[model samples]
Target: MERIEIENLAVQIRAARLEDAGIITRHRYPGEMGEHLAVYEDWLPTVFIGGVYLGWLAQSDGRVIGGAGLLLINWQPSRTDPHPLRGRVVNVFVEPDFRGRGVARSLMQTALAEARRLGLSTLNLGTSEQGRPLYASLGFQAAATEMWLKIKTEHGLSGDSPASNRIP
Candidate 1:
């Protein structure tokens, strides 16, 4: 197979718009149920409300190749600390054809720059097995042991089923 020239691909990191919600959602979690789109659409407005930053579209001759972004995540106010400094690197995705090139690295660099610009003290992400190496090379260290427990609901859950364990 011919290689996609790294120099030919131009990544443009910009703020995500409402119209790009579908693409962003699908890119974030490929193979997810169609109904999940609603969840992202609902959150898009709020996510970008206080001006969440988003990276988008690695373009080559006007064809979009990949995208990534950093979101401004805020922890809930509590008695101990009213405000906390935290952020999340999310929606990081690259087109299959663009893999092996520097597209993802470029996107991540942009995201980190944005995080620093936003004055966030820490940034977090949950990565799949395939993504761990890439993240590790970028200086991200595995800190805590994350655990999850799922309980199946009766009547066979459908695409429209609501997620019960949502955080406030």
Candidate 2:
């Protein structure tokens, strides 16, 4: 991994690999401070293995301090571009000790570069209140309408194949 100095802090930023999946998963905080929450259930390298997801890791002193992921979403063709390529930046995190030192900024820059290289027409991300300022400064606009659906295994979802008894 090549090292880059940020704000006088020597940091190494490298492409994330399959072996780093656990590191990325473990580093995720998933919510506000003191939330004690994580996205453990979805912490799999399948996406990374599938090649649609590209990620980067920021390391210092032989340990990973931060990371970011870019996921390419396949959507229906639009009018302007029959096959519009869209990328979503996710899992942007920096260790508490490494915050405010440009680690996240560097990672975000790297992700953007990769997105451009991949010919992505649009990039999107959902930011927490704390990260809003940074993202806004980087030119990410707010989405006017966003909707989500969470499938609860105990209720709408079932432990076996989403209640369909078969995996889709």
Candidate 3:
């Protein structure tokens, strides 16, 4: 069967392969610290190779135009989901030129389908305000009081911060 997005655009939303690691990484363009990428960039290929992290890629005209990643997480049990695990949709991105063309949406839909195939009862994501409406339209609600605490030794975090290396 053929996969297409946007009537005549010939976009294909397909499983990203190990060979696509570089292209996917380029699209993600991680944070300033780059620690997440540094620790897990190679691991992307490893997990995909191991069938642990399934990545979705959107391609058009022989170029990667968008992408997203899905991973199973062992989150605490919730009333809505008694299961010990949930799915995480992360690193969603689309080329600037491809915005408003449904490339990101296509990638997300693919990820959701994969999650259902994996029998995940719930899914979650962290998103910017710009992307909120699209995600909300797809049934993603903001997590309750989701918070972030980046404990870096250089950032005045207590010596007991998780990032601290020297043992007390």
Candidate 4:
């Protein structure tokens, strides 16, 4: 890990590895912050080793303070984008104590650099209200017509009601 000083804070940024899967999974779930995807524990290691996902970690004093992940998805080349690969920026998180100190910004910059190096045509991310400003400042615009649907099957989604499936 090479040390980079951000706003007077010395932080080291490094590429994430398969051994870091457990820590990365915990950061993604963060108890009470979001829904826990139990399968991620098993899936991440495969992705990490398969080269489908590349991630960066920001550490200070030998402890992880922030991180970001870039997932490459295969897509058909369109007229607008001639590249067959698209990148999704995922699981960007910064510890509360490290916020507003350029940790997230550094992590994102690293992710973007990797995307460019990989020849990805477009990079996309889902951001919360609080994270919107930071992403917007990095040249990400609001994507129109984004929507999702949850299909109920035999397994069923816990506490899910039919009304909840409708797009608002």
Per-residue alpha-carbon lDDT of model 4 for 1-168, expressed as tens digits? 768999888899999998888778877766533233456767998888889989899999899998899988887788999998899888899999999988998899999888888888698887766678899999999778788876568855344332443331
Clashing pairs in 4: none
The lDDT leader among the candidates is: 4
Error of 4 at 157 (Å): 5.5
TM-score of model 2 relative to the true fold? 0.79
Global lDDT of each model? 0.67, 0.75, 0.74, 0.82
Candidate 2 backbone clash number:
0
Worst lDDT 10-window in candidate 2: 159-168
Clashes of each: 0, 0, 0, 0
Pairwise lDDT winner, candidates 3 and 4? 4
Query: What TM-score does candidate 4 get on C-alpha atoms?
Result: 0.88
On TM-score, who's better, 3 or 4? 4
Name the better of 2 and 3 by lDDT: 2
Candidates arranged by lDDT, highest first: 4, 2, 3, 1
Candidate 4 Cα misplacement greater than 4 A, ranges: 33-37, 155-168
Candidate 3 on 107-157: residue-level lDDT in tens? 888888888887788898767676799899999886677656554566442
Cand. 3 Cα-lDDT: 0.74
Worst 10 residues of 1 by lDDT: 159-168
Looking at model 3, residue 156 earns an lDDT score of: 49
Query: For residues 1-168, what per-residue lDDT tens digits would candidate 1 score against the true structure?
Result: 112346666555455576777777777766677655677767776766667655554566555566776776667655654447566777778778778778777777767877778666677787766667888999999876755665666843355334443211
Which residue pairs collide in model 3, if any? none
Tell me, what's the RMSD of every candidate? Answer: 6.1, 6.7, 6.0, 3.4
